[model samples]
Target chain A: MSLFGRQSKRDLHSLAAPYALDALEPHERARFEKHLRTCDRCTAEVRALSEDAVRLAWSTAAPAPLAMRDRVLAAVRNTPQEASPLGAAPPRPHHLPAHVWGTEPPPPRRRAPRMRPLFAPLATATAAAALVVASLFAVQATRTQDQLDTARAQSREIANILAAPDARATNERDARGRGIGVIASAKEGRAIVTLSGLGDLPSGRVHQLWLMRPDVQPRSLGLFQGDTPLVTSGMNDDATSLAVTVEPNGGSAQPTSQPIAQLALKSVGFGE
Target chain B: MEADELLVRVAGGDQKAFEELYGLVSGPVFGLVRRVVRDPAQSEEVAQEVLLELWRSAGRFDPGRGSALSWILTLAHRRAVDRVRSARAATEREQREGMRAHHPAFDQVAEEVEAGLEREWVRHCLERLTSLQRQSVTLAYYDGYTYREVAEQLSLPLGTVKTRMRDGLTRLRECLGGVA
Candidate 1:
């Protein structure tokens, strides 16, 4: 579907050029990105268009000021290079379908002819068991590695957002005067909610964050547990306030209880 | 070494390769940033950030995707556009209205930058596109206007601008492919 409505395949394909040129709006760009992952034709078209755009970019080549060379080179000297290529690859989707690990049992292996030595079958059985155990360990290791990579990438994104010149934070208090801190960047469309001074919730309940905009329905940002800061992105640009509510675990489609804390967001100059 | 090879070495902490890569890309990066950012000082600053990011994220460069030049330029453009948008967003309403009135002058500056044989060829290709297509592509790519802004500027519908840009770029790509 198009960002605003259903789009025909041709309409989606037409987005490749604008997408490559970085001309689409944020929401439209996002929708086209989702479409790009599954559409080979559009993907190839975008790649080709991007290469052309680079040429177009090069056509505007005015010499950079001579002073920049020394500064950049000096900075490079002071910086340490990456130790590995772990986070270089785009994060692969980690979810695996349940059916991938087929439910049916393998057919029993046919018995070797009577002439075959008994020890051979016994050795094969032992090797098979060993292989199965090894494979299981390998899968577990890979899953752990994927999770580590994801966490590392996320931490990097959070750090960048926090470092943004426009990043702003506000401390909010509930009716009971508990603190909830919020850090947000409107340009980046990201926010981090930090729960502080709020005691642990009882079982079967969670804290859900909502973005309230003038004349717009409150939209759920996310649900979180524990006191750690939760990072959220793709926030509505017009949201003027943030709120937290107690909801049933797994989060409600809509708020079911009064907000525990609320904070009005003040616009801060970003990218200064 | 090629840009990709230099990037790999840079990833492995080769300062020499990093310096060489900087020499290769810094001009185009600065130029691209200047197109979108307008202010030379701010463009230079943004270019520095983009180059620094390239050094820091060299290991993440996936050669299988595209050439190193395209990737770096893409990043430069993104940073430049972000700077422009954020700066505009911060200005008061009257100031933004004033900016909208004068935004078309930026396109003239873009046109004036086209020099040399290579640029002349590009200009030729660009001119070959219909006026609407040219305006849409130039405003979006060079002036850093979003499709919505382009539509609004041209007094055309959003869908019309999208189609024009796509068709325009497709033709430009085909033309450049032949020349390259």
Candidate 2:
């Protein structure tokens, strides 16, 4: 009995158990999800079977090593609770080049295209070339539109964070009183670090952000390029300060250089 | 506070609630990952990831969909399965081809070692399944093998494996009702 033999609802229904278990092949999973959008029966079955699986999960419960509890609680203290609306967009892939912001130069034109006019009648070839150029422009236009959409979605995420009631911003300045950086943190532990006036670095170096809590070593949040704002979801709630240091590219396991600047966070709004 | 209520507080950025929720679910979450990954160190890492994710995404949890424990365990299971599947794909492929030729039939002795009443009930329910059904369910659920891999391991047709799993889970669901 081939599972895919029929396109009927009953055929898709049989997949509920496997689907809930994450056992379906990617393609089959996709198909079932499309069906699941409308099939309440399958949805109910999956929910029920999932409860049963959870029971089986509980039956195997053994105490996690004691150390895990400490680590998990410490992490929770540092992590932000995400607002539901912010999760609507699928997470953007990390480590994407800055070109996703549409800043990269367009590819150079092929030299062969310039030479094509010599062999064909100049007028006819020019007309055909114009058509090709128009098509290429359309493709580039589509790609640029996609980049714009992504930027807009990202901007919305930033706006949502900033608009949070508990949001607080602090400016960090260099020795000459020049504001070099800003850190915005919320009660939820979400932080956005934005930098300015730090001229571009030579190759093999990047700016890294660290969260410094009393009685704990600074933890590296991640590295960022250009002057774009860096969003960190796990800024420690107890972190007294945020700092930026220059590190070898791809970032170091720890801050290897003195921080160029640091922002001391003050408890604001609600009583601490 | 209950797990669900604590999760609600966690969503409101209550660190104390988040800590409580972790204390509540971490054991079951770790045990489930340990069962599938069978590596204490890696399982701990995966369990940590799941708990942190739960904290970060607490707002996304809808109590109407399922209990907090179920949702957390499901997430842990998926992450653990993903880790083991990618890590063992090549080795599992080779072993799966000759698995039936050399592997002994599913052992009953292993099932008897579960001492608690809950585990005993699970074993009893699992025993009621046909041997093939039991094997299919255990491989797919506990071992974290995909149905295709389960079929390969058992040297059975994919359709038969799928049918058996669906039937086995349906039976388990009925037998463990109220008690579960």
Candidate 3:
């Protein structure tokens, strides 16, 4: 945002009310804000009026669609934030490619195998490390630097979730043998998924993730291009498992196909 | 944790802090946007933009400047108004208003019990303002109208509408301030 606007020399004090209510037009707002910098009394009044405006805002509280949480969080994870003048920079550690999968293997604390099989040969693996200094949730190792650069803010998030005390991993393999690793933190109500050995998708199809709750409709986490690590948040208490479905292009609001892989979270039905 | 504390963490790029913050603020942000923008789809889009902006600009938040909730709502309201002012959105909004006149809007579901009480409290506070003051504030705020437009809508003098808005908001601040 531009810190300074074209300074208005004349008395624009009467504009304060219209300004606070956002009744002023753009140029008018700039002049008032500019004038406000010099006038402490006006600033004090605007601040008080704005607090009332917040109350007006609160009076109309509406629940955003429940699904929006995951979308926004997913977006937040990848989106780079602007610098804060007051903030000390948070450490952002890169997950070196070699640290993923095989090196310094995290003890697999394999939980109950909640499986829905099209065919019966089930396989399971869990990566429950002391912390995620090494891999399993490697969006970095698998994606291009451009993709990784975009997710600079998220690299730290992926690390934090993986290292969370409640963090534990569960693995599932698709029909084509692509492995999807989900490391979830029940305490944080978030998850990071790493897809490795992904096969090419048909032109119109994409992979979509869902939080499969027992009685309610599944919540779509987001669509994935199948190359990067996926991070999703706002997992409520009832969501029993994570499911992946093949969806048509922009992705369906609801899962359109049978889940290629379903792995129960470490919740009630997931008896160890 | 307080919104300021959470915002500090968010500025430092903490996703979990951002999550808790989102839970607290999304309702007001989305509701206020919908109040001005009218269409649910467009409102959602605008709300998302505002939330993303909060992330991108978290570092710019100054605790001394204002409360986090006020700062966020101000940003949301400004964005919603900007959308309505755009030529295309302004034209589309007129059509929607005309259509809405014939077919009344479907009632939006009331949210949680806690939020209901807050709304009731604010409603009670709003009742304390004079009718003209309340009309001026609501017309400009909820309708996303400029002072000129509000004056036209209320058929009052511009100066009169401006004074009413200021008085209404001042009274509203003290009344709501007691509870908050």
Supply DockQ values for each candidate.
0.25, 0.33, 0.41
CA lDDT, candidate 2, residue A142: 37
Superposed Cα deviation of residue A187, candidate 3 (Å) = 33
**How do the residues A9-99 of candidate 1 rate in per-residue lDDT, one tens digit apiece?**
6677888888888887768877887788798888788888888778788887778887567556644543333343322222233331211
Candidates in order, TM-scores: namely: 0.55, 0.56, 0.56
Specify the poorest-scoring 10-residue window by lDDT in model 3 chain A.
A111-120
Comparison by lDDT, 2 against 3, better one: 3
Per-residue lDDT of model 2, residues B12-115, tens digit only = 88777887887788878887888777767667666666776676667667887777777778878877777666656645565778663333233331342447
**lDDT (0 to 1) per candidate:** 0.66, 0.63, 0.67
RMSD of each: 22.0, 17.0, 16.1
The TM-score that candidate 2 achieves is: 0.56
Report the Cα lDDT for residue A174, model 1. Answer: 53
**Stretches of candidate 2 above 4 Å error?**
A1-9, A84-272, B90-114
> What are the runs in model 1 whose C-alpha is more than 4 Å off?
A1-11, A81-272, B92-109
- Per-residue lDDT for A196 in model 3? 47
Q: Please give the ranking of all candidate structures by lDDT, highest first, separated by commas.
A: 3, 1, 2
